[model samples]
Target chain A: MSQFLQFLFSGLTEGAVYAMVALGFTIIYNASDVVNFAQGEFVMLGGMVTFFANAAGIPLPLAALIAILVAVVAGLALNRFAIEPARGASVVNLIIITIGASIFIKGLAQLVFDKRFHRFPAFSGDDPIRVLDATILPQSLWVLFGACAIFSGLWLFFARTLVGKAITAVAANRLAAELVGISAKRMMALSFALSAAIGAIAGILITPISPTSVEVGTLLALKGFAGAMLGGMGNPLGAVAGGLIVGIVEKMSAGYVSTNYKDAVAFIIIILTLLVLPTGLFGKARVDRV
Target chain B: MLAREEASGPAWLSVEGLASHYGRIQALRDVALTIAKGEIVSLVGANGAGKTTLLRTISGVQPASAGRIVFEGEDITTLAATARVSRGIAQVPEGRQIFGPLSVADNLRMGAYLRKDGEIAVDMDRIYALFPILAGFRARPGGSLSGGQQQMLALGRALMSRPRLLLLDEPSMGLAPVIVDQIFAAIVRLKSEGMTIFLVEQNAFAALSIADRGYALETGSVILSGNARDLLADEKVKEAYLGI
Candidate 1:
């Protein structure tokens, strides 16, 4: 029972990070029908930029803030220079563009930050707390709480705020949104910035527990995409649930089965889910009317 | 004969030598027209006659390859669609493109997106009163509403912006005669309240009956322009549009 609890705790911590990444995917995809493959790079930027800034004698909080700002600028640049120019392109062309952008960003990060895994101290401390005969890192609590807070904040933004609703209105119908004076271009930029900020928060929260490297973005992005696919695409709540499920499944498989095959678990589930339920657990099937 | 009754004020909107193209295909060709303040000016044309394209150009959705659009005596031919909307030109677009997933009340709120004043709530109440059925379905998703109700919602949404110039494109399309009557009645009410309306329709008779002035467009060119009553009685318009 203690072993199960231990795996569950680790799973939940990892799940929180995945949830944040999936959320980033959801926001950009909803706003601009484009699945941004560069989402994972924002997380890497958050961790690495903060680490390098802290090494340069900046305070931890300030470093994290600078890191988030950098990621936001990167996101805006990506949208303006890369995505916007390719507007009206086919969906496959857009996907290829994003993947190309992800590769370019990964290469840039490696050149600037070097190819070394780096870690930072936790926000609160290194204390381990006991829960039902299982020991869990205090940083795990921060990760879980951060994920919950982001989800709640996003929910309120989308539900209650005028700017948030305008973003949603653009997502629903771009032409209609423009007719009502909501600028779709501005909304697209805002979504990228918001998504980058969320991903940066995840990176900052999880870096102490899991060391980050420039190449970490590729694997993290794959797992995050899996979670988004498992949940309904474009549904924020579903993305969270999907991320948690992916994390728990991965940890449980590693704990009970051979650790060698643990990485394979997420992909296996993704394939099976796609075969059995293409729309996903919470995804609604789109109905196009004439 | 009614063409001799001069408009009481200067033209509120004027389009001159407007031409638009869809690649090599010209959608509008040298189309020119005007609307006086508080007048209901209807543009009657058949399908593919460029009525929708002209309205879209006026709203800044489609680019005009040649010619200029002036709203309120200001040259606004180069403005963006959102800018045109903010400048008080609101369009009830063809096909009633309401945000499907948003609630009816939220759809109404989106119409007032550019307004920052405190009168939003007051205007919202007025819209609800204008379309009483919408008040009952405030919580319902916009897509779930029937076609007629969605049309009403679209009109109400446009009105929520408190636009000085309302551009309506085929509001009576695909609706029952009763619902069409209701929409026309609402348009008449808005005109009485001093709104300048530019209406485009393939339903020529219904549009001309309510319009003070009317224009006949054919194959992307304005073939006839005069008083609504004169155009309604013209033998050519009768044979071509009214099936008289």
Candidate 2:
């Protein structure tokens, strides 16, 4: 029983990070219909830049803030320079652009931050907390809480605020949104910035638990994309649920089945979900009248 | 009916020799029209006759390759669609493109996104009063509404922007005659309240009946223009558009 509980705790902590990444995917995808493969790089940037800033004697909170700010600027630059120039391109072409962007960012990070893995101290101390005979890291709780806070913040923003609804209106119908005075271009840039900030928070929360290298973004992005596909592509709530499911399933499979194939589980579930339920668990099938 | 005195002033909106193309295919060719403040002008045409294309150009969604569009005596031909909207030109696009996943209330709120005043709530109440059915479905997703109700929501949404010129593209399409009557009645009420409307429609009889001045468009050009009542009685318009 304690073993099961331990696996569950670890699964949940990991799932929280994936959930944040999935959310980033969903926001950009909704705003521009582009699945930004560079999402994971924001995570790496958060951890890496914070690590360097902390090494330079800045406080942890301030370092994290700088990281977030840097990530937002990078996101804006990506939208303005890369995405905007290639507007109205085919979906496949857009996907390739993001993929190319991911590779370019990864290469740039390796050059800027070196190839070594690095981690910083946890936000709350490295002590372990026990729950029902199972021990969990304090940082894990921080990850879980951070994820919950972000989800709630996004919900409030989309549900209660006018600007947030304008973003959603653009996602729903770009032409109609423009006709009603919502600037789709501005909304796209905002989505990128917001998504990047969310991703940076995820990175800051998880780096203490899992040391991050410059190349870590590739694996994280693949897992996050799988999570997004598992949840419906554009649904924020579904992305969270999908990410949690992926994380839990991965941990459970590693514990019960085979640790060697733990990574394989996410891909398998993604494939099966796509084959059987293409619209995803929470996605509504789109219907258009001619 | 209100007097047509508003039509005698300088044009509130003017399109001079406007031309648009879909790549190599020209959708509008040197099309010209004008609307004065507080005048309900109708552009009646058959499908593929460039009515929608012209309206879209005026709204700045479709770019004009040539000529100029002037709104309120200022040349606004180079403005973006959202800028045009901010300048008091709101379009209830064809097919009622309400945000399907959003609540009807949120759809209405989206229309007032650019407004910076405190009277948005009052305007919202007015919209609710205008389309009471929408008020009842305020919490429901816009996609769930029936066709006629969606049409009302679309019109109410446009009105939420407090636009000076309302551009409606086929407000009566795909609706039952009774619902069409209800929508037209609401439009008549708006005009009586001093709203300027640029209506585009294939339903010539319904459009011309309410319009003070009407233009007949055919194959990307304005072929005829006259008083709506006179056009309604024209033999050529009756044969080609009204099918009477």
Candidate 3:
């Protein structure tokens, strides 16, 4: 029973990261139809830049704040330089552009920071807290709390706020949003900023456990993309649910099956979900107008 | 562009020599139309008669291939759709393009997104009062609403913008007769409130009954235009558009 509890906690912590990344994917996908492959770079940037900033003697909170700011700006640049220029381009072209961006950021990270893995101290104390005979690290709690806070924030932003509704409007029908005076261009930029900020938060929270490296983004991006697909693209709630599902599945698979093939579990679930219910758990199938 | 400048002549909205196309197929050709302040003008036509194209071009969604669009005595032919919207032109597009995932209340708020006023809640209450059905379903996702209710939501959303000119496209499409009566009654109420409206409808007889004036558009050009009562009584209009 303790073993099961341990796996559940561990799964939730990892799932939080995927949930944040999936939320990031949802924002960009809603604002622009392009599925951004470079989304993982935001995570890398958050971890690496904060690591360097902390090394330079900055406080951890300040370093995290700076990392988030940098990620937002970088995300805006990605939208402006890469996404906007390729507007109306084929989906395959968008895929290439974002993938190319991911590679470019990875290369830039190697040039700017050392290739060695880096870690930051946990936000709170490093004491292990026991719940029902399951010991969990303090940092894991921080990650879980951060994920919950972000999800709540996004829910309020989309459901209650006017600007958020405009974003929702653009997501639903760009032409209609524009006809009602919502600037689709500005909304697009804001989506990228929001997406990157969410990714940065995920990175900052997980850096202690996961460590930071230039190449870390590739696998994280893939998993995050998978989670988003599993939840249904363009759905924020689905992103969170999908992230938790993937995380728990991977944890259970590693515990009961084979640790080496843990990653395969997420992919298998995604394939099955797509084959069975293509729109996903919380996603609605879009009705085609005749 | 030059034609747009001339169309800015002391009218709520004016268009001259307006042309639009979908690829090589021209949807609107040299279409000229105008609406006076506080007047309800209806553009009645059959499907494929370019009524929608004309409204879209005026709102800046479908750019004009040639000619000018002036709103409130200013040239807006070159502005983007959002910009035009901020200048007091709001459109309730055909098929009622409400955000399906959003709540009915949130959808209405999206209409007032550009407004800096703090009384959004007040405006929302006003919309609810106008369409009690929407108020009852304000918490429901827009997609959950029936077709007639969605049209009401769309029109209510457009009203949230406090637009000086409201352009409605085919508001009667796919609606039951009872709902159509409600929608038409709402238009009458709006007109009584001194709203300037440009209405496009395939239901020519119903539209003509509510309009102060009416224009007959065929293949993107106005073949006949006169007082609404006169157009309703015309033999050609009755045969071509009214299904008489």
Candidate 4:
């Protein structure tokens, strides 16, 4: 029973990180219809930049803030230099651009920070807290709660704020958004900044428990994309649910089936889910009432 | 070219040597027209006569290859579409594009996004008065409304911007005649209340009847311009546009 509980806690922590990444994917997707493959790089940037900044004697909180700002700048630059120029391109073309951006970001990360795995000290210390005979690290709780806070905060932002509604408007119909005086381009840039901030926060939270390297973004992006696909492309609640489920399933499969085959679980879930619900668990099916 | 009657006031908006292109195809060519304040100037055209493109260029959505658009004697030829909104230019696009997931009232509120005044609630009330059905669906998602109701919502949303000059494109499209009448009545009422309107439509007779002056566009150029009554009575306009 304790073993099961341990796996659950471990799964939740991993799920929290994936959830944030999936959310970042959903935000950009909704606002601009682009699946930002560079999302994982933002996460890596958060951890890698802060890890070095702290090494250079910057306080952890300040370093974390700097990392977030850096990620936001990167996000805006990505939109301005890459995404905006390629506006009206085919979906496949846009996806390839993002993939290219991810590679470019990965290269830059390796250049700035070496190819070494790095870990930051936990926010509340490295103490292990026991709950019902299951020991979970304090950092895991932080990751879980941070993700929850982000999700709720986004919910309010989208539901109750004017700027949020404008973003929603842009996603619904870009031409209409412009007719009403809302700049779809500005909204797209804002979406990028927002997703980057979320990705960075995820990176900062998860670095304590799991060591990050320059190349961590590739696998994290692939796995987080799987979670997004499992949830439904543009559904926030689905993204979170799908990510948590993905995490738990991977951990369970690793514990019970085979540790080496753990990574295959995401593909399997995707294949099975696709075979049944091709629109995803929460994806809204395209239905034209004409 | 017909001489514009500027008896009331100088032109509130003028499009001079306006041209727009879609790759190899030119959608508008040297299109020139003017709308005086308090005038309902309607542009009537066939399915592909560049009527929509002209409206789009004036709204700053479609790029103008060569030309200048002047609003209130200020050159806004290079202004972005978003800045044009705060400049009191609001457009109701061809299809009523309501944000589907937004509530009816929330959708209305989005029109007032650039407004810093405290009269938004008051303006919202005015919109509700114009379309009473929208008030009942205040909390419902905008997409759930029927086509005619969606049109009403779109108009209400544009009015929320409190625009001095309103550009409406094919407002009567896909709507029942009674609903069209209601919308036209609303437009006339808006005009009477000091709103400058530029109406683009395929319904020539209906458009000219409400308009003080009319311009007819063919392919991508203005083929005819005159008093609305004169165009309605013209043999060429009757055969080509009014289906006489």
Clash count, one per candidate: 0, 0, 1, 0
Docking class for candidate 3: medium
Question: Model 2: per-residue lDDT, tens digit, B1-244?
Answer: 2112344454389899999999999999988888988889999999999998998999998999999999988899999988888888999999999888788999998888888888788888898888888889989888788889989988988988888899999999999999999999999998898888999999999999999999999999999998999999999999999999
**TM-scores across all candidates?**
0.97, 0.96, 0.91, 0.97
lDDT by residue (tens digit), candidate 1, A1-290: 99999999999899889889999999999999998888889998999999999989999999999999999999999999999999999878988898898899889998898899999999889989999889999999999999999999999999899899889999989988989889999999999999999988899899999999998887788788888889988889889999898898899999999789877877986897799977777999654232
Write one digit per residue (lDDT tens) for candidate 4, span B157-224. 98888887889999999999999999999998888777889999999999999999999999999999
**Candidate 1 wrong stretches, greater than 4 Å:** A286-290, B1-11
Q: Model 3 misses residue A211 by how many Å?
A: 1.2
lDDT of 4 at A219: 76
CA displacement after TM-score superposition, residue B100 of candidate 2 (Å):
0.7
The lowest-lDDT stretch of 10 consecutive residues in candidate 4 chain A is: A281-290
Q: What is the lDDT of residue B13 in candidate 3?
A: 84
Write down the lDDT of every candidate, Cα atoms only: 0.90, 0.90, 0.88, 0.90
lDDT of 1 by residue, B42-150 (tens): 9998999999899989988889999999987799999998989888889999999988888899999999999888888888888888889999999988888898999
Return the TM-score for chain B, candidate 4.
Answer: 0.95
Error in Å for residue B190 of model 1:
0.5
Please give the distance, in angstroms, between residue A107's alpha carbon in candidate 4 and its true position after superposition.
0.8
Expressed as tens digits, the lDDT of each residue in A155-267 for candidate 3 is 99987777888888888888888888888889999999999999999999999987989888887787787788888888889999999888888898898788999888778
lDDT at B39, model 3: 84
Residue A277's lDDT within candidate 4 is 80
**DockQ per candidate:** 0.60, 0.59, 0.49, 0.58
Flag regions of model 4 displaced more than 4 Å: A286-290, B1-11
Better of 3 and 4 by lDDT: 4
Give the i-RMS of model 4 in Å: 1.9
